[model samples]
Target: MPEPTARVEPDEIRRWLSERAAYYLERPVEELDPGAPLAELGLDSVYALTLCGDVEDRYGLVLEPSAAWDHPTLDALTAHLLAALERG
Candidate 1:
């Protein structure tokens, strides 16, 4: 079996999110606008849910399935994630 990936550090979560978004959106990382809403990107509900699941597992957080919609932008999501981790 493949080794599990290491947990992401709080500070690095933003960058990781950005990269993931870029991947799902099929755009280059530099082409992404961190401030723009993720819904405006090419992401559908399915991808958003998948991303939420990944986030929960990667960060060991108990996040809602609608986390992507609730956070909206990459920056917003990053801040929310950091706060969640801090609270834990």
Candidate 2:
């Protein structure tokens, strides 16, 4: 098996989320918050999947299909991602 990469910090996760949110929502990164729900921020299922793909590409992490529902907020998602990274 390939060695796992180091886990990203919360701030870095937040930054990554903000950038991805901006890209998917076509809005300014300054407006995104880690506590905001993706649905509340205009993310539908398709957009969420696309965002997941972007995250996987950026971080080399594969997200579960249910991640969008399970980790609804950016903060929750970041926490889950960090945990997954640690486990890997």
lDDT of each: 0.80, 0.79
Tell me the TM-score of each prediction against the true structure. Answer: 0.83, 0.85
Candidate 2 structure quality by residue, lDDT tens digits, 1-88? 2236654687787778778878888999888776889899887898788878877887778887678779998889888877877776
Colliding residue pairs in candidate 1? none
lDDT of 1 at 25: 81
* Residue-by-residue lDDT tens digits, candidate 1, 33-78: 8888888877788888888878877777767878888999888899
Number of colliding residue pairs in model 1? 0
In model 2, residue pairs whose N, Cα or C atoms come closer than 3 Å (at least 3 residues apart or on different chains), thus clashing, are none
| C-alpha lDDT of candidate 1 relative to the true structure | 0.80
> How large an RMSD does model 2 have?
2.6
